[model samples]
Target: MNETEQRRATQLLQLARNGDAESLETLLASYIGYLKVLSHSQLDPRVRGRLSASDLVQESLLEAHRDFTKFAGTTTAEFTGWLRKILVNNAARAVETHLLAAKRDYRREYSLDLLRQAADESHARLNSMTAVHRRGPASEAEHQEDLTVLSNAIEKLSTEYREVIVLRHVEGLTFADIAIRMNRSAGASRMLWMRAIEKLREAMSNENHE
Candidate 1:
């Protein structure tokens, strides 16, 4: 997010926290793309086909809306973190419903902790790629804005570029694995990934300038 966007978000957050229903709706709507990306990255592969990221994100957003009054944090990062927790929880439930419906020891197969850790790892990787650091302690709002910016940039890429980026970065797949998944040679996968990164960087650069 840029300065103008950040200021707007802060204003919306304050209004939402103070019981403005329309402001709350607007605030949550702004995060739909970011939430969708997080939901897609954190969803378990076993249940990817069974559950769509949009559905998971919608569920989470509804829950967030219902519980917005309970949220006490004052920064965008805290709000984003709260929403991510909801997304992870919903994703874990989806995984269990689809992948462990018949298993008696389903708990052994999956845990919310594992999903949360995966989300954290993905967040760290994305932050490393897109974050611009300053000398002093960076504010939480700045970190959250970086994520929002990156998510929007990713959403603007071509489908093939987006797929390669999610596979290589979000999923942490090796080039060989991505090659197999994408039905290309390892060298070809690497090339595609390079192109995807270049495009992504350009998109992010344009976003920052805007």
Candidate 2:
């Protein structure tokens, strides 16, 4: 969300708050990619194969739509925070539902607070990946746009490339741990991670150019 996007969102928020259903839909639709990134970050890895991040994002968006009138925020940050809370709650429910169906003990493995913490950590990791660290402190909207750009770039990566980057950076896995998870030698995992970083950088560069 840059200045233009923030202004547009504020306008839409005003309209949606005034009972403009179409504006509400458009506003929610604009956040699909952003929410998907959050969903992917917050989703428990054990259940990822069984549940798609897009599904969780859709569920969150639907809930947001139903409860739009309850939203009282005026700024984009407030609105984004509200949406993030919805996404986390929906993710928790989805994870619990799947784990229970599989007869697994979700209580021992997951919690809402943990999910929220993970989301924050993931976003922080993403922020660190950007030029924001070299520049001075970025505005909240700039940070949001950077995350969205990085997420979209990650989505364009090949499966193995994406997995290595996510495991090494997003999940903070060591080379040895990543080797075990990726079923490769430690050295091989290191090489793969390096290559993955290169590809991710390329993808992100392309995203910026676009």
Candidate 1 per-residue lDDT, tens place, 14-115, comes to: 888888998888778778868877776777767778788888889999999999988989877678778889999999888778877877576765788988
Error of 1 at 56 (Å): 1.0
Q: What TM-score goes with each of the models?
A: 0.84, 0.78
lDDT of each: 0.80, 0.77
Error of 1 at 46 (Å): 3.7
Weakest 10 consecutive residues of candidate 2 by summed lDDT: 1-10
**Model 1: which residue pairs collide?**
none
lDDT of 2 at 145: 60
Error of 2 at 67 (Å): 2.3
Model 1 Cα shift for residue 202 (angstroms): 3.6
TM-score of 2: 0.78
Q: List the residue pairs that clash in candidate 2.
A: none
Candidate 1 residue 43 Cα shift, in angstroms, is 1.9
Tens digit of lDDT per residue, candidate 2, span 1-210? 344344466677788888989889877876786677567668877778878888888888999999988998887668888888898888888778877567666675678898777776765666677664247776655665666667777778888988787777776789999999889999999999899888888887887676
Cα distance off (Å), candidate 2, residue 85? 2.1
